[model samples]
Target: MAQWNPSEEYIENTRLYKWMQKLGYSEYDLFHQQSINDVEWFWRRVEKELGIPWLNHYDRVLDVEKGIQWPKWYVNGKLNAYELALGQWAKDPIMTQKEALIWEGEDGEVRRYTFSSLATEVNKVAAGLKKLDVKRGDVVALYMPMIPETIMALMAVSKIGAIFTPVFSGYGQEAIATRIAASRAKLVITVDSSQRKGKEIMLKDELDKALLNCPEVESVVVVRRTKTKAVQLKEKHIAWEELLSHQPCLEIEPMNSDEPLMLLYTSGTTGKPKGTVHTHSGFPIKAGFDAGICMDLKRQDTLFWYTDMGWMMGPFLVYGGWVNGATIMLYEGSPDFPNADRLWQLIDRYHISHLGISPTLIRSLMRHGDNWLTQKLSSLRVIASTGEPWNDDAWYWLFEKVGKEKIPIFNYTGGTEIAGGILGNVLVRPIKVSMFNAALPGMSAYVADCWGNQMENQVGELVLTKPWVGMTNGFWEQPKRYLKTYWSRWPNMWIHGDWAITDEDGYWKITGRSDDIINVAGKRVGPSEVETILASHHYVHEAGAIGIPDHRKGDALICFAVLQESIEMTNTVKETLLDFLSVKLGKSLRPNDIHFISDLPKTKNGKVMRRLIKNAYLHLKLGDISSIENPNVLDEIAQLKRPGQKNL
Candidate 1:
């Protein structure tokens, strides 16, 4: 057992503890003791305490005879997420006219919608969808930017009990077509164009190209955004406003809790995206619970998360904030556009209370220095990070600059499958370097090695031992793939393919993906290990390392590095880095070669695309190059390849 106890000072000073006290818990000891000793009772109490409205009650709270295979939760219960998010709130006199969504575009355009107004818009869209012949279980593909209409469309689809599959606006036509076709979508909602970095992108044209390959799509609804010349509408194409002009704003169809709500795809090692299906009750409830208790969100709080509708974070952010009656802030542009301080300016202007971002963005801000971030972030109460593992330097910089080293940086980790974070850092926990203080309540997580044996203080695969409410039902149209990917490796555990370790302090640290682990001379070395070491170098701005097939060493560590402006790539510098690595991690773990480049390949959200780097090195045909932010970086790295060397 771990003797991990939070400091009294930290608990008393934290926003989470104060909220718990306001909720009637005088101390963390009482709350934790009650939570652990009676988990079912605690969850039941939470369901009631959080004011979750249910039309039908359950006979039993939990049924475990089926194990993870078919564990029934809230048996005999009937509650729809749509009702909990909009219906009850809309009925309440105090919350009816309150602002629920606040949206801002890249071109200084702003829009606000109240709870009642949002419900009206959602009902109109829902009626429009019904007129277009959409029915329960029918898939609706959303290929739009982060706009208010997108949120309305999501709620409209869920209200009518249809499954929504959102494709990122940054994705190319081919990627979009693949997802739409795979889901056999009956309709697609998009816009003529979208603004990003002060430029208008032709989104409808891209959708046109994608729809050519997706014949199952019966109709397309286009929203006017950039005031660009409209495309020639086909028999199936209709303007968004025209479609909903005469629709009523009071129609809503409730759904069962276990019905599919959304399908989010996760790119696998082979580049084939797996569609993860989340149920209505499983995801929305979990997201709201975590946002309310863990984030300590309030009605007056404004939550801003820089994300697209395609990512799981988008839905998580929407449900989490809306269910808590907090205002949701949506930004439709690049984070670094116009200036490096754009995000900061928005926070200051909007009085945002909670800010969620990735570590890569923070590191980029760190590269630009702290002059902009040093401004008064008085409205900011907490900072949250996800998507990729954060380095110590970035973590410290974020806590120092944005949070003043006093606020909690909730380092959370889960995936599209779980819908929300399985492990997270509560506000009362001590801040550490890239560590998750604890798993979410009712979740049981463990670290195990390759032999299925539990490990401690050693890196291993992260697994969930018990089934939770937020767990995905299965993959969309591919139940076998779901079983093979997560459940086949372990009898009853869900093995998330990531490398993690727990410290003696009971804090968990994630390295990189287990599939990305390098085998050098029969020894295992995670890419994060070498990348972390390389990031420690002052001259190295960013680095991504991968293992390539080597005739002599079996698999050798090949590193690609980006340099700072004042740093130059020279033979001496490379040797110095090699020597530094030798001194720090021993010569055996030293990188075989380090190639300096202008930038590392990344996704739009700033996650390093290491698979692309490995593919470039081996001269392999790059799959789904559409998701890369800088596809040219691969060609630039390819130019440095030696003659007759294998191309990744």
Candidate 2:
């Protein structure tokens, strides 16, 4: 059953419908087929429709001479991402004064920036970078929080044709040091301090510790976010105010379309984190297309996605909102801080229209009841979600209590490597609960087995047969490793490392990561299936399911459950859940054991790290846990293992 079906008025009013009409197509399937079959023509039309002001038009839309993995897009085109996203908007006399960016701090502080003012700040920072001898192609690390300066720094680097990589604010010394060293960054920008839930974090101190071993870093720029203490000026240090005090240079670098724009590093299950490279025209344009045409982020509308700069959604918010000329809203605080209503208050206060979040956040907020939903979210039109799979209970709660069953939830799924989404719920189609209505146009997405045979109605690896504009050129100077990670899985096919299933109705749902699937006896099942069943019970707040080594069954399902607040774990509750799972998932699929805990390990973005949970329980070596939000939970999970269980 569909949760949201577009009305006639809604369908006709969308940018997608308008674009389809321009292309003389009324049906989505035909348009999507044309998009993938003739991608060059489709992409050329996309840029023109988006009104991209190219300094020099490309002679060719795409050149696949180097093969699909290394296809050069927009051959010979000259444009800067900063220009498309901000400079052009500011040049418009009327839109110059409109709110381009709005920010709110946890301490009740608020700031607003107009297009013209933001451009000026960005130009000043660009000049400062030049003064510090940061040349084109230079890598600069942004170890700052989700503040206005972070956006300024991002645009500034792009304006000068330099690259910037954002580090998560919650990262410790080693994590920050690792990225800076890996990128060989020339300069680093950070905040003096930041506040989260009334606690001060010394961000500069962490950077200082990281810079100790990052020999390539020549300078540091510090923003006074909390103004906790005056930064001591060293040879390599400069104040944010000082950087802004420089003469504003209004020169926009005319960069080649394929020039490096940003290097976003994403952690893997094993080995080192991969540096996914995104080009100037690549990331911004794809992000704009997804936000504008797919999600309907119109001009003057406020777009807000709760995330940090380190995350992919962070850049998505900046470039996506800016390219569409929409107002981007940032909240530099915990989502549920002084009260559970903080996110709701922000939406109502800012009149945000397009809101993005994770299913984990919705699950967390459901614990507080409906009292926090006091604000009338009349301005909100759509809700978008990514990061992890959604459970039926949490999905229904958000759709009913928050949206009143009127607004649509656009389930988006992709990765940093793809720049934007491969599968999403476009407004043109009816949206099913917790599933994608369509694979995003221009992406040749399908579910297939290891050998590339297409499959339906069963779980299979999500693979892309052709390259799209936003596809990463390759990992930063590690072509062999990049090939081994994605392309090596099957010849020429990009294995996205996710397990997906499509129903006869054409709706798609991501089960879980391929590595997270558990095989018990001869049946393989995604952890989300079992977790969803566990979470459906009234006593269980959330759950993490993993497979432990079994002597006879090959793999036995083990579940760790977090109980609702004020609820105590008992044998009765455990038996009730286990029996309920057997009824829902069948006798063979039921969990072998269930343990109660206070919390599950998660990332700052609210994604539960099940790999860490399994490693902790098995007393195995946990690798690359820098993204973990609560490390202490691992210790708690480790203590729950029975005495007889050996390390797998």
Candidate 3:
């Protein structure tokens, strides 16, 4: 069969086609190389193409005086993110009246919003923040569910030039307080309670507890969402309704493009979480550019990404979709709620052109069977994936069952620090199962060996050679730490901690985190490399591979696998599994132990907590596990020790 390329709908009608004409480049490789080789001209054209306004034009596109560690973008340009995202579409009658926000709850509640109405609500929150003294450089935090108001609060905070950070709704007090205090945010937005999977999660109650430790928090804005009894309002607590009852300011503040916009705290291997800072021009512009070119999103499209407000995808979806003038769908509960068809229903109802989700979600749904995925989804032109690398079984299931093998899996990889993707599948190319077509146009990413030499076939570290828009300013108040984290590994290159490989066919695959590369015996292998081999088995749903110290071979591998439902692990079955893995990975690298479990520990964003597994196996202190979604599973894993193992 012939390979599929960018659809006619994209090449014929999208703004990318218009830009291709303007740049006089019909081929993607030529455009990609030019975008990197001439950074200044490329970004200037991109900003203009996106119709982003610059009250004061940039003196230059990039400034490297501070070196790549802190290269300034769009220097001297002044613009509002709200203005950038809204652009000329805010004035269009059809766009203003078009349904821009779609929301549904686990309890059968649904809400839709026109762009004008959404803007009004966002302005009301902005006005309220202004009234509460949330000034231009002040930080406001949101610990809320994936509700329309959650996104509105984010937009409103950006509208007034206040840096906003979001804590996951399911987080405990300690996790919430840690981020709120670290960012020193004065105002917080949250719901009194929220419903998820038919259960009530007390959001405002947890916020109040978190605030007790966060002396920086001066006030709270509460959304009354659940049917739980209303509690008495405290001195610092105010209702969302009360804030919106007042007249909205209806004005956006234009700030310098380089001004801070958000402070998201991501966990590190070291003890504490680092607060990553993103700027006004950086995150929004990069996100929009990725959505426009990679996802081929147009204003006529509707985007629905299964995510929580806490994850980067939440902000990525909102900023990326709107910044490109596409309608966005936000669901507030479990991806699998009353039934497994919930996600498909959203796609069907909203006519989602771009559907973003994680490979873990697909793996989880794959176990539930594809009976619910029977709905017609011709509108889904792109199946966007991130959070983690894909296993063959889950990748094939998603492509065949969900996308009907027609849509491309737009594999993307970057991090909160980048504010957008580094490597991603572009619309111009044909994706090979689970691979990135190329690095996003502007990023100069490459796979290199430990000594900084570029590698071929063999897996190596992923490095970005040139700085791009949306690279975080730095860890909040920790510039030295930021340099040591990303730039210290290599002289000038940004060592992005992830492991990757490029095949002879020019396809790229992010194997796993560089730090996560398990050195068993003498061969270094990424966890995903082994996990993928195991997950390909008919009985294995998902697998977590960890390296434990082996006095015999320097280090040995262990795999904790979540088997398919109703599958029993007999001795014969175990032997068969071990032999199968040996054939795929060779006897020298085959895992010493394979334990079956009900679930694997993961964060809300769906990344496996591999370190937790290693720590548990090594009998080391299990550090801050506040981000773990399923902590109980860790206890189950801790009980499974190899032969002759004592402490475990």
Candidate 4:
């Protein structure tokens, strides 16, 4: 059954509706069909509709002579990415005085900046970067938290035609060093300290340790977010205030449409992190399209996505919100700090219209109950979800309780390489509980078997047949590796490394990553099928399910569950959960054992790293442990498998 149905008024007010009308199409399916079939016509119209500020318009919208894997977008166009997102807005008389950024620190500190003020800060920092001899094409690394300076520095770097790579603030020294060395970053931007859970973390101190292995990094620019402790600065370190004190230079460097804008790295399940390259026109334009048209983000809206700058959504938040002339909100601390009502309080206080969150967060917040949501979210019209797939119970809670059954939860899923969403819920269509109603226009997505034949209702690999605007230019300095990873699988299809299914009504659902699937006897099962059942239990907070080798059935399923606070580990609790799983997921697919753990390894974005759990359980090498939020948690799993305990 559909959870939310769009009324005629709702459909008419959507940006998608207006764009479709401009294109002379009355039906969304027809528009979407032509969008992927006649690629040039569709994207050209999108550019005109978006009013992309081009110094020189493109001769061709797309070129595929190099093959579908390496298609070029906005061929020969000239425009700065910053101009599309914020530069043009700052120059508009009507938008200049409108709030562009609103930041709230963990310590109850608030700061707001208008478009004009933000432009001035960016201009000064750009001039300061020039003074430091940071030339065009130089790579800069930002290791700061979600503060105003972080956004300012990113825009400043792009305005000067330099590539900026953001590192996650929660990372330790090794992870920081790995990215800096891989990108060969020239300048590193960081904070002296950042607050989290009522404690101050020394960011500069960690970066200093990382810099020891990154001699290529010539200078460090420090943003002093908190002065609770004295920070010792080295000779190459520059204060953020000093950069802002420089004379403002309003000049914007004109860049080719394909010039590198940001180099984002993703720590895959194994091996070194892959650097996904995004161009000046690619990331921002696609992000803008996804945010503005698909989600109906508007100029009067305040958009807040709970994310760290280290991830794709961090940059997505900045470009997506600003490109549409919307106000972006940033919060520095944990969403559940002090009390479970923290997120609810912020939503009411800020009057946020469009909000983005992960399903993991919603599951974590479920324990707090509905009492925390005391205020009516009158201003919130849309709630967007990404990061991981949603279980039915969590999805229902978010829709029925948090949104009061009046708002639609836009289930969004894409990756760093895709820039934004490949599959998302469009406002023109009726939304189901946890499925994407449509593939975002311009994405030729389908579920297919190993031989590239399309399938329905049966689980298969999710593949894209055509190139889209925001597809990553290539992996930084690793073209062959990129081709081998995505395009090498099929003739012309981009194998997205995910397993998905499509229903008869054309809605899509992602089961899990292709590699995360488990084979038991002859049946194939995604780990989420098991984890979802475990998550439904009252005592369980979160769970990681993995398949291990078994002589009897080829593979045996095992689980690690984190119970709620003060819940004792007992045989009855395990038997009850085992009985629950047996009822929910049949006896044939029940987990062989459930090991209670304190925490599961996760990324800063709240995605549980199931592969790492499996690696530790099987005594395999835990490859690329850089992105995990808790590296120590792996030791606990390793201890469980040590010499004396009972084995599965």
lDDT of 4 by residue, 1-648 (tens): 799999999999999998999889879899999999998898888778777999788899999999988888889999998898789889999999999999999889999999989998999999999998888899999999999999999999999999999987876665678788999999999999999999998889878988899989999999888987888878989998888787997888999998999999875434456789999989998998999999999996999999889888999999999888999999999898889989888899999999998876787788788888887889999999987778788899999999989999999988789999999999999999889999999999999997999989999999999999889988999898889888898899899888999999999998766776554432334577567658868899998888776533445778888998867899999898887776544444667889999999999888888879988877789989888889999988987753235888
TM-score of each: 0.78, 0.82, 0.81, 0.83
The sequence of per-residue lDDT tens digits that candidate 1 reaches over residues 1-648 is: 221234687567554577568667875546755664565676676666567777687777667785674556677777777777777787789999988888989888899998898888888888888888899899999999999999989888888888999987776665677678888999999998888778888878878877898999999998888886766677888898976775664655656666788898765543346788887767888788788778777776999988878878889888888778888999999777788888998898889999988776677677778776645878987788877677777787787667776667888888788888878887666657678887766666779988778889999999877766767878888877888888888798888888899888778888766777565543344577567667778988898888876533445778878888898889998888776655444444577888889998999989888888888867787889887889999998767764236788
Clashes of each: 8, 0, 0, 0
lDDT (Cα, tens digit) per residue for candidate 2, span 526-556: 6775686678789889998998765334467
RMSD of each: 11.5, 11.1, 11.1, 10.6
Candidate 3, 1-648: lDDT as tens digits: 213465766565656666776789878788889988988888888787777867677787889898878889988988878776653456678788877788988887899887888888888888888888889999989898888888888888888888899886666665677778888988998888888778887777777776888998889888888847786679978999887876887777888888998887775544346788888899888898888766788886888888777767888898889888889888887888888888888888878899998776787677789788888987888888887777777888888778777888888888788888998877666778778878888888889997998887989999988888899899998888899888897799999888899998778988766676565432445577578768878988998887775544435778877888867977676777777776555454677888888899899899888999877766689999999999888888777767566772
User: What TM value does model 4 have?
Assistant: 0.83
Worst 10 residues of 4 by lDDT: 517-526
Regions more than 4 Å wrong, model 2? 516-648
> Which residue pairs of candidate 1 clash?
615-648, 616-648, 617-648, 618-647, 618-648, 619-647, 619-648, 620-648
Cα TM-score of candidate 2: 0.82
Candidate 3 lDDT at 557 equals 78
Q: All models: lDDT? A: 0.78, 0.87, 0.80, 0.87
Global CA lDDT computed for model 1: 0.78
Ranking of predictions according to TM-score: 4, 2, 3, 1
